[model samples]
Target: MLVYLRLLKESLSFAINALRNNKLRTLLSLLGVTIGIFSIIAVLAAVDSLDRKISKDLSSLDKNTIYLMKYCFGPSEIPQWKREQFPNVKYDEYISLKNSLTNTDQVAYQFFVNKETIKYDSKTVSDVNIVPASNEIVEIEGLNVDNGRFYTESESNSGTAVIVLGYDIAEGLFGGSEPVGKSIRLYGQRFTVIGVIAKQGAGFFGDSNDTSVYIPTNFLRRMYGDNDAMTPVIVLKPVKGVDMDAYKAQVAQKLRAIRGMKAGEMDNFFINVLSGFTDFIDGILGQMNVVGWVISGFSLLVGGFGIANIMFVSVKERTNLIGIQKSLGAKNRFILFQFLFEAVILSVIGGIIGLLLVWGISLALTQLLDFEFVLSLGNILLGTGISAIIGLISGILPAISAANLDPVEAIRTGM
Candidate 1:
């Protein structure tokens, strides 16, 4: 054990001395390693940050809730006429479906109409997202009111011209003044503000929840003067104490009945739970990960070759020294180990610098570019491991050449 430790210490000392002796060559070799490791770490940090943002955004939707829509989230290949076939599902249909479902505690239906500029006096806000939703949206969607209150079921049934403002919208229109009970004009019609939603921040796609406005579905329909049923996106939550799986089955059965679909026939409406959406997103990220590694692996391979060439040059320059060491009774294995140790040291230092660079870039992105930064243990390990492997392999040929040198001939030629 002591002999092994001594050998390791000697190898490190020798490697250090060699690095110090060849200042320019060492810098250039380390630069290659730095570039390779920088690529890996930068890619990994970006992927980690992207994954985190995506997971956070997806998780924003309720786990037990399902979306009832006319189209699938995975693809845009749905026939255009299919949406026309439904036109709009009636509000009465929602009550009928809710009554039929014994396992569901709450169900909310929502849809959006074409956006119109909201005007308050001379101030105008055009970037507002307007959603028409049922009263159950307050419960099923886990909404919190920042001021006033959400519109009542009675109000929705009567098609009351009431609006609920999101935090950003409220601030933009009211300028920190109380907006509840005030009037705002949308689509040439005046609507009274009843509530302001708490801030929900931004999703991964940069969609801001606070920039939205909500109102009764009936009010939205009335604004269009269309009794035609709009395709409602229904969100349902299971009753407390009911087993989720059983509730899902019961809800499915009830929805099929309401849609008047016979058994074995596909239902017209789509139901999307957490699993399908998460799986779809994960599959995309998985493909990205594979592609990123394949590209970065090529960069690492090229960098390894650069290190090998530099080491070869170094070995040739130190031929006389190697011969002297051999003449002083150094073993072939000792000479090989010294060169290998130097290569590993160089690679590791470059890797550390690369990691630091990545961290700096991540900080800059978060502070200046509004991107989230994430660092993971897995990525760190991957970068370090790849760098070490590059060093070991790159050192092989040079190490072997140094080990196999003819000491007498080397001394005679001063090589």
Candidate 2:
């Protein structure tokens, strides 16, 4: 064991000396490996940032609340025929679904208005989002009111035209003045501000909560011209002791019947459980992992080719040197191990530099994107392992040639 360690130490020292002697050649050979690793690491950093932000955004919703939408994320668009079927979940349907769920804790529907603007006296603010949803939206969204209360069902049904401002919007509209019960003009319609939502930190894309305005779903519909067929979103919460999977299945059956879906007709509505959303995010990351590996592996291959070419040149230059080593009674295995160790050392150095660069890029991205930087220890290990393997394989032919050189002939001919 001690002998093995000593040999390893000597091999490493020799490899380092060789690299130092030919700095330009060593760096030129390392370029392919560096480029390959850089590509993969950049991708990893970007994907990591995006994943963390999306996860946080999705997690903001109550775990018990299921999101009912027309389509899931990604490229799939909801079919027009399917969207037409649900038009709007009427007051009656909402009540019926809520009543039918024995384990339901809360149920709410959303009405979104994009043209919503808030005006205080002469100053007007755009980028105001208005969501007219049931009071249950507060509970489902884990919203905390800075002051005042979320409007009740009765207030919503009454179409009181009262508005709740997100933190930023409240400040913009009323400044230091108490905003509650104060009137603000929205799309030429006057609304009494009733509450302010507590500040929610920047979302996945660094968007602040202060830009939102809330009103009753009924009020939003009345003010913006309700399309009876417009159901923006449905939030459902299941009670304790109820099986979520079974309950979700039951809920789907009821919704299909309400929407008049036929058997095996492929229901158009989408049900988004928290777990399912998490899985979707993981799936996207998994694909990115594949891409990173393939691209990095290709780069490693090119680097290995560079090493093999270099080793071939070294073998030709040192033909007489190999012959001298053989004449001194060195074994073929020793010569082979020497070249292989040299190749591995070069690859390892390149990999270390590449990893450091990746880490630096990750830190920069985290600051710029305001998202998490996830560095996978597994990926680093995998990259290093592959690079070492490339070194060993690329050295094989050159090592064999070095080991088999004829001492008398090589020394005499200087070839």
Candidate 3:
């Protein structure tokens, strides 16, 4: 073991010396490896950061939550034309489901509306997201109120002019002052501020509660009647520990009965599960990973070839030294390992440089974009492991050739 360690030390020294002696050649050879590692690790780190952020943003909600709507969240077998013609989920249907569905924990009604502006005196916040939802949305969405309280069921049912401001909206309108009990104008009507949501950072796909305001769904219904362009959806949370498939089946049956669908007729509405949306995200991530690997694989191939070429040249240059070492009782295994270790050391150096670059850029991005970019330990290990494997594959042939040299013939040829 000591002898092998000594060989390793000598090989490292030789590798460094080679780098110093042929600086341009070494740099050129390492460029491919460095770029490859950078491309792969950077892509992976970005994807991982995005995935984590999405999971954190969604952590408060139950994965078993179901969204019943006219349109699906992901791709569906139903034709787009047919989906477009499907009737929207109504408040009455939501009420029926809430009262009849025994397997559900909670049910809420919401309207998907366009961006609108809010006015508090002369201070106007434009293009703010407006969520018109039932009071049950507070429990279903796991909303946190930093001040006052969400509108009560009576307020929602009565279509009272009460609003819950998001963190940013409240700050924009009232600054450091208490926003609750203040009046805000929307759709040319005044509404009393009932609550303010706690601060929530950016969410996946730009959906954040920070710049939003929630009002009673019935208010919107009364303002525009049910024939407006707004899409109404029913959100349902299933009871814990219930069989999800069975629960979903029950939900579909109860909705079918309420909607008066015939036994053989197809259901008009789409049932989108939260877990299914997560699975769709996973699929997208998987595709990105595959593309990254394929593109980076080409760069690694070029790097492997460069290393192999340099190793062959090194063997040729050291023919006489190899012959002398063999004559002085050096074993073939030692000669082979010496060259192999040199290749590995060179590749590992390139990989380490790439990792450093990634770390620096990650820090810069986090600061500049106000988004976290993580470089996890597992990804660093993967980069190192991949580099070592490339080195081993690239060095085998050159090392074998050096180890098999005829001592006298190599000496004569060198001379």
Candidate 4:
């Protein structure tokens, strides 16, 4: 072990000297490895960051939460024309499910409506997301109220002219003043502000609650009279510890019965589960990973070739030294390991530089974009491991040739 440690030290020193003496050559040879490591690590870091953001955005909601809607969230066997023909989930269905579904924790009715402008005196905020939802949405979505409270079930059922403001919307319209009890105008009607949502930062999707205002779904129904353009969904949260498949089946059966579907007729509505959406995201991330690997693999191949070529040249240049060392009783294993270690050290240096570059850029991006760009420890380890493997594969043949050289023949050839 002591001898091997000494050999490693010598090999590292030799590698450093080679780099210093042949600066341009060494740089050119290592560039491929540096770029390769940078590409792979950067891609991995980006994907990891995206995954984290999605997880953070969805963390508050139960993965078992289900959305019953006319449209599917993911790819579906149902044709687009047929999907378009499916009737929108009505407020009545929401009420029926809320009262009838026994295996549920919470049920919510929500509407997807056109963007509307909101006004407070002279200050107007345009293109704000207007959410018309039942009072139960507050509990289903796990929303936090920074001030005031969400509208009650009575207010929702009565279609009262009351509104709940998101953090940004409240700040924009009311600034630092007390927004609760203040009135805001929407659709040419005045609505008294009843609550304000807590600040929720940027979301993975553009649907963060910060820029939204919520009112009773019945209010929209009353205003528009069941407009065809407005899409309504019934969101369900299943009871904890319940068999999800059984629960979904039960929900489906109930819906089918409520909708009056015949025994053999197909169900019109699509059931989109939160977990399925997450699985879809995972599939997309997996594809991105595969693409990153394929593109970066070419650069790594070139890097390996460059290292191999340099190692062979180094062997040729040091034939006489190898012969002398062999004559002095150095073993073949020592000679092989010496060269192998040198190659690995060189590759690792390049990989480290690449990793540092990635870290710096990631930090810059996080600051510039206000989105966290993560560089996990696992990815760093993966980069280092890949570099070492490349070095070993590239240096093997040259190391073996050097180790197997006949002392007299090597000396004669070098002279």
> What pairs collide in candidate 2?
87-229, 87-230, 88-229, 103-239, 168-210
User: What is the alpha-carbon lDDT for the whole of candidate 2?
Assistant: 0.75
Which pairs clash inside model 1? Answer: 88-229, 88-230, 320-415
Name the Cα RMSD for model 1. 3.5
Per-residue lDDT of model 1, residues 31-118, tens digit only: 7677777877787688778878877655545566777666666664557677446434555567777777776768877875556679
TM, every model: 0.85, 0.79, 0.96, 0.96
Report clashes for each candidate as comma-separated counts. Answer: 3, 5, 0, 0
- The digit string of per-residue lDDT tens for model 3 on 1-415 reads 9998999999999999999999999888888888889889988998999899989888888999999998899998888888888889888889988899987888999999999989999899999999999999999889999899999999999899999999999999999999999999999999999899999987776758898899999998898889658989999999899898998899889999998999999889888999999989989998998899999999999999888888898899999999999988898998999999999998888888888999999999999987899999999999998988888889999999999998888888789
lDDT of each: 0.77, 0.75, 0.91, 0.92
Error of 1 at 57 (Å): 2.9
TM-score of structure candidate 2: 0.79
Ranking of predictions according to TM-score:
3, 4, 1, 2
lDDT of 2 by residue, 1-415 (tens): 7866666787788668768888898788877777676667667766766776676676667555677766454434666666656344455556667777667888987864454567899877887767778778887877778988778878887777888889988888778989898888976788888899998766764444567878888776676555643447777878766788898898888887877889997766667776676677788788997898798778878888888877787777777877787789877777777777777777777777787888887788678965667767865775577667777888888878877778777676565
Poorly placed runs, candidate 3 (over 4 Å): none
**What stretches of model 4 exceed 4 Å from their correct place?**
none
Residue 320, candidate 1: C-alpha displacement in angstroms: 1.3
